[model samples]
Target: MDTHFIAFVLRALAVRLHTNRDFLSWYEHTKPDFILCTNFLGGSVIASIAKRANLKVPIFVYAADVFNNPKAGYCSKIDRLFIPTELGVKNLLSQGYTKEQVRLSPFPLQPSIQQMEKLSKSEARKLLGLEDCFTLLLNLGGEGIGSTALVKQLIKNKLAWQVVVVGNLSEASKQRFHALAKQLPGMSMHTPGFVSNIGHFMLACDVQAGKAGANALMESLSLGRPFLINELLHAARNTQTFFLEYQVGWVIRQPKQQMITLKAFAEDKTRQQRIEYNLKALPLQFDSDQFVNLLLNEVKSLAD
Candidate 1:
């Protein structure tokens, strides 16, 4: 009766039945010392394939989400499991992994994002030609799911706050936002659909709103911007605690409610300063080089 259980069973059956001759052939041809994988499904498949190949290759899996399933015994096949948060490490430990079997690593931001120039609030606003007023960044992942509702609330309430919405919005959604932009002439509504320089946009805003996805959360914190999370996936469920515990942000839903909080937050400069300071204090962001070196050192140690 449980949907998750049924889905898990179907996936397990598929994993058992799945076979890729090309993958196996390629593995045999290349014969790497070890394998590093990003997701559980791929890691499990690679582990099964490696065992079938009769190779003593090590497999490392960096869990993209906090794996709450303690019964996921397939993870034992992984030589090392890397988790990004202390809460994740706790979850895996409770999942029966040994101390040596798990490694705690910060989620590494993309090189472009990490290396981007850190701009002051005034400098960032100037670069984007944003008004020196309360600004909010609404980026609900690539699909831009919750953005329209929030923007409508802002328009209906006649709020003059600046909004920067960045996502791969549908054409219809773009037209809708364009029309709405005309209604709120005082507000600076920037709907730069699907931008590459998201870090710059983030720096220009006082707060970010979206799903508590791994990348979005890390990117916001890396830029020292507080995140107003509305949705959470299974993997991101633990992130709520991180936000609450650190006084960095709040988890609120409903466009009207979010607007109310946004208005209040905008007026409270001391609170904004506190949240920004807290965001900067968290040890969440890492560079690409550090991530690569960490993996390389681990592989060398295993080889030795």
Candidate 2:
């Protein structure tokens, strides 16, 4: 979208590719209007590339997460830093970045409001071949870890529930989960690997158990699925706080604690009801469109 929008603004724009060997030479020859870098690439690499190019083009950095430790080495080279939330902006200020250099930019989804349709729970379950019972969707991100063992233990305990594991799994992990699925006769366990229809699966289940990635959290909220955040490393506690503040999910303190919580949720109907109430109260709407617009405007301002 950014590339297409830029093309729309500029007439007779010629795009070129520059290899590492000829990057400086190409930059000197072309002298492009502006340089925009996404946060995933980090500020250091962008700064180095711009300095080596020896071009006066304005450099803009878009940070998707909170900048807890912002130092001069990272901030000095960036002309402007685009952040996702007001919390991010405050974090930047604490790191000594001037207000002028910081801009609020949120993440955007490809699908618009019209595409935000949801399937009924029964319809979604039927489509996915899930049994008509209490189901839990366990998503361990791209790397499917702790799934095989977790499902096996859940089944061994003879819990009246369905376990569905989603995401990419290694060959060994796949075999293990498959064996467990076969062992548990009445307990229907399914492992549909690397599926694009995540929304369907999310809507089919009563609750979600997974890591606290921002994208995953937002998707769960958008689908109105109550999530159980797995225990994370100490460094990632701040990131987990975002979900806690919104009351969309509960955080597990450890692997054993996760199992205890799940067991309790399954047994205690009152606790489950309270959790469902909190999940319904969470805000479904996100400011992704506003973020995209701010980013586009900032890019245009820099280009002008």
Best by lDDT: 1
Q: What's every prediction's RMSD, in angstroms?
A: 2.8, 8.1
lDDT of 1 by residue, 1-304 (tens): 3233543453455336645456677777998888988876676667656666666888898887642322343445668887777777888787667898888876778877888899987788899888877888889577767657787888888887888877888777777777887888797777787888888888888889998777787777778888888876655677778777888877877778988888788888897788878877875646667777778888988889
TM-score of each model, paired residue for residue: 0.89, 0.73
- Model 2, span 1-304: residue lDDT tens: 2232333222112112233336566667887666666653345344555655566777777664432322322545567887655666777676667888887665444363215557888988998888878888988777666535456567667664787888787777767776777766777767886788788888888788877655665577667777787745432355556555765567875656666668887788887777767767753335566766676677688667
Candidate 1 residue pairs in clash (backbone atoms < 3 Å): none
Clashing pairs in 2: 106-291
Clashes of each: 0, 1
Give the Å error, residue 181, model 2.
4.0
Best by TM-score: 1
